[model samples]
Target: MKPAAFEYHAPATAGEAVELLAEWGDEAKAIAGGQSLMPMMLLRLTVFDHLVDLRRLHELRGIRQREQAVWIGAGTTHSAVGRSDLIRQSAPLLARATPLIGHAQIRNRGTLGGSIAHADAAAEYPAVALTLDAEFELLSPRGTRTVAAADFFTGMWATALEPDELLTGITVPEWHGRRGFAIEEFARRSGDFAMAGATVAVGLDADSRIDRCAIGLFGLGPGPERAHHIEREVLGSHVREVSAEEVGRAATARLTSVPADLHGSANYRKRLGAVLVARAWQRAVEEATDD
Candidate 1:
């Protein structure tokens, strides 16, 4: 199927894109990479009178450390993110999670901001962003503002972005050293959307004990969700003594309150979520404790 006829506007700057959005409002859609928007457009699930292409916005196209956080241009490709040494050193959780998004081809074209804006409940980036407490930058005619990842994703395929705003960048705190991070998902194939998944990040104190931890769950809720109860349970525990079964049981109790779905029963998804969480926690602990 072909997308509906629309006027195309390629903007070389975010300000130019914002101007287009301000003029067209709900009738226009800002497209970066087209990985998410184009498919929906072709199926007519959504329509636009104008398409604002953002590939030429060079201002929004790099990854660098600013203050205590790493700012990634919204236009940065998943492939570039997955392969970035800077990301690997500063925010390894994000680097680890990027390859889990889809196949190589999908990663090649998928933009970080595009995925975040799309807000796929089972997508890797949203969960990672949430786990990392990432911040999103939104530009509009009004001005630019930042939104925390926790508040950015409001629902499945929904975000806090106003119709006239464009996502310009993402900021993640630098994870320095002595940190463990992992991403795990259950799916039928390599590129399939996950049936269940979890992204985990842990910071160990000098004593080699869990000091801080963040767990973001996907495919088990309306949107990416932080497993706060589980994080609380694991804090202060020694990495060597961490128990997957205990963590899994706790996660099951917390996540199974919802109804079932066609992909799996609510209980099944909860179980999957628990197992993934446990696996991620264990792996992250190992990575963090590595000499």
Candidate 2:
């Protein structure tokens, strides 16, 4: 099977890309890396008549740090972000979760903005972005708009992006060595999509006690979502003394019911999700405490 015939345009700037989108209207689709879209197109799941390529757009291709956050250009590859020492030091959660996204080949070509825009529930970016409260920069023919990660995802395989909108970048808050972050999942293969997974980034205080925590799990909902009760319970507790079982229990209390597919049954996923949450939090706490 082949993708439908389409005009391909490699735009030099985001504006030019927007213009092409405007011209093509509903027939146009913005492509970056094409790690995800290419497969969908070949399967005939996607049928765009015009392909707007953003690879030539130089503006969306760098990582910058500010007092408040790190601004990752839309074009930055997952492998680039994963290997950057700065990202590891500043936002280790992203670094830790990147390798879990897919294999090296996919990570080398897949872009952060593309992953976020693609909004795959089993993907890592959505979980990390949601955990960190990252902001998305969307550019359109009219102007630009910023969307918070939580609000950006509406449902399965869906996002807040409009037909004419192009995601230009993502802004992640700066790390203050608050807490250590950790990730865990139960998958059959090294690079396989998680049947169930969890990511925890916690910040500790001078007293070596938990200050705050963000917990998210994949394969438990429409997308990776916060384990709200677990976060609330973990706050103020010393990381070392916390039990993985307790953390898992808290997560199960909130996200016990989720959709089930070929991965596992809803019951099995719910129980396993709690376990992953506990382990991820405990590992994150230990990491933070060790430093």
Candidate 3:
């Protein structure tokens, strides 16, 4: 199907994009890469009176290491994230997960900000961001504001971004200690949205005890869900001492609230969540231990 006719405006800078959004109000939709929005628009699932193109916003593109964080511009593509040596060194978990997003072609055209802004429950980035505790920078005509990943995603296909706000960049803290990270996702095919997935980041103390850990899972709730209970349980326990089955059980129990969908039953999804978390946790432990 063809999309409805709309006025198109290409902005050279983020401020210009903000001004365009402010002028068009809710009628305007900012597009970068157009991986998600274009399909929805073509199907008439979503319509916009004005299309604000952000391809020229060079300010919103790059990867850099600041004092204690890695800053990734919103315009950076998934392929870039997957291939970046800086990201591989500073944010290994993200690097590991980026390649798993669709395939090479999708990765080439899909933007990091687009995926996060889309906030699809089945997306890999949202769960990864939540695990990394990444920060999102949102720009608007009024001003700029930063939101933690936990607060940025409000619900399925929903976020805290105002209609006039454009996500400018993402900030991920550097992991300094002995760390291991892993992403485990189950999809019918290589490029399909995951049925259930887990992104785990684990850091070990000198004694090999789990000092810090994050478990972010998706495909089980309105949006990506954090496995807080599992984290609490794993902390202080040695990876060798922790029972993945027990952790899996605990994970399954906490997901009672996730609704059933056509792809999976609520119970089935809960089981998959448990399995993913256990596998991701085990692998992360191994990686961190080897480091």
Candidate 4:
């Protein structure tokens, strides 16, 4: 099957793209990279009367360091992100997670913003964004605004972005001190989507006490989720005294909406999620302690 006939508009600037979106309303879809959207369109899973191509918007395609955070343009491809030394240094979790997003071909054309906006619960980028407390920049005719990662993802394939808005960039705050980040996922094969996964970031005080921790889970719920209860449970505890297995259990215990599908049952995913969390926690803690 082929996508429905649609008028294609390649806009040179983001303002023009959003203007087209505003004019077409729900009938227009802004495309970047087209890794995800093209497939959906090809399958006829989604249809748009107008396709707003953002490939020519050069402003949305760079990686830069701000005063305290790393700002990545929305159009930056996964391949570019994976190869960025700046990203590896300032936002290691995002860098490490890049290779896990499908194969090289997909990463070559898949944009970071496209993945985040698509909001697949099983994708690595969304979970990493949530774990790092990244902020998203949105542009519309009304003006630009920022939304925190936690508040941006609303539901399955849904986000806080309005119809007329365009995601221009993402800001990931850099963590200082004895900090460690790790991402673990259980995929059946190297390029397969994860059945369950977790991204962990830990910050330890000089005395090796857990000062702060963020655990983000994916492929276990309707959208990427933060393990707030588990985070609170481990704070202030000495790293040696914290049990990775117990933390994993606590992380999955509070999840009320783990998804069940052909791959696994809800209970099975929760179990896998627990194991991934434990693995990720242990790796993050080891790195933090080694520092």
Candidate 5:
């Protein structure tokens, strides 16, 4: 199947792209790597009268290191992100999650912003972004603004982005001190989307007590979810004193909207999520303690 007929507009500047999107409104869609959009379009799941191509916009395609956080342009490919030294050193969770996105061919053509904007509950990038507390930069005719990861994702395949807004970049803050990051997911096959997954980031004090932690869960709810209640439970507790199984149970117990589908029931997903979270928690704590 082929996509429905659409006018393709390649804009050299982000401002031009924003204007095009603003002008077309609901009739248009901004396309970056087109990995996810093209598939849906081909399947006739979605239709757009116009496609605002952003490939030519140089402003949305680089990685930069800031004083405290690393800024990744929205158009940066998953392949580039995986290979980036800055991303590996400054934001290791994002780097670790990159390879699990899909196969090499898919990652080669998929962009970071596209993944987050698509907001798939089963995708690795969105969960990682939430775990790291990343910030998204948005541009529109009205001007620019930033949205925190917590508020950006509204539901499955939906976001807080307005019709005319373009996601220009992402800022992932660096975690200083004794810290560890890990991502674990249960996919049926190497390139398959995860059935359930968890991304864990832990920070420890000198005495090996958990100072801060973030547990990001995906493939278990309407959108990527944070295990806030679990984090609060483990904070200030000695790493050895916290049981991974107990933490996992607490995290999954707090979930209110686990999705059921052909793959599994909601209860099944919650169970899988619990195991993954426990595994990730153990791994992250081990690393943090080693540091």
Candidate 6:
């Protein structure tokens, strides 16, 4: 398979990248890591006239930790984030979710920003980003603006990014050492796209009652959806004594008519969704206790 004819431009700086995107508009697409885009290009699923290579941009290649949050460069690879000492120690739920993305080779080349921009409904980054309430930095010729993760994904393979916008980086609140988190996905193999997935992030108050929680799940909707009903159900109780199965059932029931595919029937996926959510909640509770 071969990609359609396209101009390849590697820019060494974010400014150059945005300028080229401004020049080419819809004909140009940003290429960072190429873990997802390259395969699509080979299939001719996307016909780009220009690929603004972002690999050489040193500025978009590292993770930074601030007192309040963590900044991940758009060009940072999944492997990098998974193995990063800073991310593993501080935002480990992210590190936990990365390996679930794909195999070693794919992880080695996939960029966090690229995955979020791609917005695959079955992908890990989207759910993780949503779980963290992350914000994106999208750059265009006019300027840069931040978009909340919840407002980023519009639908399958779609985002709020404009035609000329390039996602430069993401900012996520630091874990704050008060939460217990878990990520679980059902895939055919070790690195296959998730058939169903769930991530639970919960914070406990001094009374051990759930204070706040975020549940991000995928493979049952147009995009990742927050399990608000489930979170609310658990917020006033201790996870150990709460009826997690009931919460899981309610959450799974809401996805009764999920879209189906060769990997799973809608019913089967719904079942997996319930199971994953339950297990993730259990793990989160244990971790919260330990914390």
RMSD of 6: 1.4
Query: What ranges in model 2 sit over 4 Å off?
Result: none
Question: What TM-score fits each model?
Answer: 0.95, 0.94, 0.97, 0.99, 0.99, 0.96
- The sequence of per-residue lDDT tens digits that candidate 4 reaches over residues 1-291 is 899999999998999999999999999999999998999999999999999998899999999999989999999999999999999999999999998999999999999999999999899999999999999999999999999999999999999999999999999999999999999999989999899999999999999999999999999998999999889988999999999999899999999999888879999999999999999999999999994
Better of 2 and 6 by lDDT: 6
lDDT of 2: 0.86
**TM-score result, candidate 2:** 0.94
Tens digit per residue, CA lDDT, model 3, 39-156 = 9999999999999998888899999998899999999999999989999999999999898898888899999999999999989999999999999999999999999999999987
lDDT of 5 by residue, 1-291 (tens): 999999999998999999999999999999989989999999999999999998898899999999899999999999999999999999999999999988999999899999999998899999999999999999999999999999999998999999899999999999999998899999989999999999999999999989999999999988999999989988999999999999889889989899888889999999999999999999998888884
Which stretches in model 4 have alpha-carbon errors above 4 Å? none
- Judge candidate 5 at residue 291 and give its lDDT: 40
- Give the per-residue lDDT of model 1 (tens digit) for 231-277: 89889988778786677667656664443667688878888888998
Instruction: State the local distance difference test value for candidate 1.
Output: 0.88
Q: Model 4 residue 269 lDDT?
A: 94
Worst 10 residues of 2 by lDDT: 248-257
Compared with the true structure, all predictions reach lDDT values of 0.88, 0.86, 0.90, 0.95, 0.94, 0.87
* Candidate with more favorable, higher TM-score: 3 or 5: 5
Model 4's number of clashes is 0
Q: Over 4 Å off in model 5, which ranges? A: none
- When summed lDDT is taken over every stretch of 10 residues in candidate 4, the lowest stretch is 254-263
User: What is the C-alpha lDDT profile of model 6 across 76-165, one tens digit per residue?
Assistant: 999999999988777778999987888899889889999999999999999999988999999888999999999999988999999888
Q: After superposition, how far is residue 206 of candidate 1 from its true place, in Å?
A: 2.2
Question: RMSD of each candidate?
Answer: 1.6, 1.7, 1.2, 0.7, 0.8, 1.4
Measured by TM-score, how close is model 4 to the native structure?
0.99
lDDT of 2 at 203: 89
